[model samples]
Target: MNALKINTFIGRQYDSNFPEVITDAVPITNPLAVDKAYNILEENEGDYLYGFVSLIYNDVVIFGEEQLTECLLDTWSTFSYLLESRYDGSKHHIIFLDNYPYINTTIQENGQYYEIQLDQYQCFLVPIEPFKKELKKEFFNFVEFCKNEKLWFSEESSYRGLLETYNEIKISK
Candidate 1:
């Protein structure tokens, strides 16, 4: 899974390594004020600060729901219009962590090179409500609309799995 690359600094000042695709970035500070992002994040587990940007595939992942509340909240302060202007269901996404998660890219400055190490893998989808009933409700509603509208639902179409799952969910309910 190739994640959107975000340039992070180990000791504050970010470099120009930021990917052109990721237009939004955190505040340029020696130590990012992750404390300020608290309202969006679950309270800090301890004394640590870090920042992140994500390109989530969708609300649902191989893992679970793309917990975007914090990322969405931070964009209000940091990116301002990035999310609202460009929230394509599968491309733009965000997540928050109290600590640094990925290894910073190393670069040669002047004549010297440095490596900014991150503590965690930096590419994990934060674990949120895996079985969100609200999202499921929306999905089922879409499926119902499809059934009503007969969207690609002919005998030759591939809705057998969908019908089977719908039947299972119906029976369980």
Candidate 2:
């Protein structure tokens, strides 16, 4: 398969120069995304980190491969929408997961894909069955992170409405 270069996404690189960061001074995830700046004492310190912002998604998500595929197609279809049917754009499905936080590789590298399906709870980077080629994935950067949040549970599609309807369906206990 031809590897496409995708610069846009949740964890896209803002610039070549990364601001100095010291992550997790204390335990537990913070409620908000953290992308702070710090002073680097020496140039060598720069080698240690790939500074980028990743959004915190603190939710109990129960999704399967079908849901994961749906998300992948949604993201890719939305991305390809700009083309207006001129050509077939890449689905840009995530290839592999290495259980890592930083997405510092390119579309041609391993772990590039992002859609992760699960039976329940928490985000993790687990390699799927295909074991295909992967792309570099950055965590949710500031801008993309905010943009994505806007798409969730809008007036046209409220979670409360869905939940209410779902509860109406009586399954015999």
Candidate number achieving the greatest TM-score relative to the actual structure? 1
Please report the TM-score between candidate 2 and the true structure. 0.19
CA lDDT of every candidate: 0.29, 0.25
Number of the top-ranking candidate, with lDDT as the measure: 1
Question: Which residue segments of model 2 deviate by more than 4 Å?
Answer: 1-36, 40-44, 47-58, 61-114, 117-173
Candidate 1 clashes between residue pairs 3 or more apart in a chain or in different chains: none
Clashes of each: 0, 5
lDDT of 1 at 81: 19
TM of each candidate vs. truth: 0.27, 0.19
Root-mean-square deviation of every model:
19.7, 16.3
lDDT of model 1, residue 71? 25
Clash count for candidate 1 is 0
Q: Which portions of model 1 show Cα errors greater than 4 Å?
A: 1-131, 154-156
